[model samples]
Structures are given as structure tokens and as C-alpha cells.
Target: MKRLVAILVIILILIVLGLLSIWRLSQDMDVYVSRIDTIQQSVEQKSPDLSLIAQTRQDWENEMQLLTLFLYHSALDEMAEKWLEVELFCREGNYSAAHNTLSLLRQDWEQLYFQELPIPQNIL
Candidate 1:
């Protein structure tokens, strides 16, 4: 029937849109992880690069806006606080603290990335 065909079409469109959003989120998360790794390396070398952290923080703020569409606000808020600590520690020339904070931030992002995937565990 035409009604059944229309319903199927709508379902197909929804599935496509869902897959596209998941793909976009995965890409963004990958970029974020890469940036965090860069910061981690800089901090691990006992060279807290304030300039790099500042630039990354600004970019993350913009990215966070987009992330809100997919992730929970609470997850984003926790990461925001960790990011602030990393920036502050870097500015104060505290490489150890900055490294720790960066690690925590990376873990949070990883968790979010894992949670967003369309895997069997996540669906169930």
C-alpha cells in the first residue's frame, strides 16, 4: 500500500540521518583526541605550552557547542572544568598537573566517543 511505502521511506530517511550524525561525531571525537595527545606530549616534556593550550581551548569551546547536539550537557560540563584546569596549570608552568588534567580530559572524551558509537552494547 502507498501508506506502507511512505512509512518505510520515512524510516529509511531517519536511519540515514542517524548514521550520518554518528559518523560526524566519530570524526569530531577523533580530532579532539588528536589535539589532546598533542597537548599531552607537550606537557609530558615538562614544557607546558600555554599558547597551544589557549588555542586548543578556544577551538574546543566552539567544538563543544556542536557536541552539545550529541552528548549530554553533564559530560561536556565535566570536560570543560578539566580543560580549565589544564589551561590554568599550563599557564602556571605546572607541567605535572597539566599532564594529569589532560589525561583526565582525554579519558572523558574517549568515554563519550565510545558511548556515541552504534555498537551492539550501546544499542542494548
Candidate 2:
């Protein structure tokens, strides 16, 4: 009887551990998915504005701040490339490019997400 009780306890512990592992994995996956959705929404809302590019360029020129320039340049380049691709896709009537661009943009977001990984300051 004691042996059977011990086995049941062991099984319960294993099940709990398995559940905990699954929960953690699901949580991480949720974060990645949420970030992807946010990026895609942002991309979809983009308007092909040369003014944005010009403004960013002017900011870089006036400040001589390498970090600002680097970030704005990189984002501008990506946005422009994606915008052009989207225009071409629209001309060709291919809606798939819009979706594909979202995937590509998600990859960019993923890279940034991993680089500046957020940590919860306080656990509620």
C-alpha cells in the first residue's frame, strides 16, 4: 500500500512539472506572437511619405548624432524598401506581398525584441 502511495505521489509531481514547462513555453510563444501582430499592424498603417524620410534625414544632418542617424536610417531604409515592394505588389495585384512583408517585418521586430529583451520590474 505504501509503495502504491509513493508511486502516485511521484506521478503527480511529474505531471505538475510537465504542466509548468508547457505553461512557460506557451507564455514565451505568446510574447513572440503578440510582437509579430504589433509589427504587422504598424506596417499596414504605413503611408509612403517622403516627408518622413526627409524629416528623418534632416534630423540626422542637424544633430550629427550617430545613434539617431543609425536607427532612423535603418528604419527608413526598411520602411522604404517595404513600401516599394508593397507598391509593386499592388501594381501586380498580388496581395500576398503585403502578407509576406508583414512576415519580414516581424523578423525585424523579433530581432529587436531579442536584443532589448524586456524584463518585468515587479511581479504582480
Which candidate number would show the highest TM-score if scored against the true structure?
Answer: 1
lDDT of 2 by residue, 1-124 (tens): 9999999999898766654443443345455456446534543555333443344335323432332322233543564465456445544545566558657755654553344323222321
Model 1 misplacement above 4 A: 1-22, 116-124
Off by over 4 Å in 2: 1-67, 70-76, 116-124
Which 10-residue window in model 1 sums to the lowest lDDT?
A: 115-124
- Clash count for each candidate, listed in order shown: 0, 0
Candidate 1 at residue 64, lDDT? 68
Local distance difference test, each candidate: 0.76, 0.47
Error of 1 at 23 (Å): 3.1
Q: What's the CA RMSD of model 1 in angstroms?
A: 4.4
Tens digits of per-residue lDDT for model 1 on 4-120?
A: 999999989877666665666666766788889998998888776678778878777776676565444577777877888999988788889889889889888888667644533
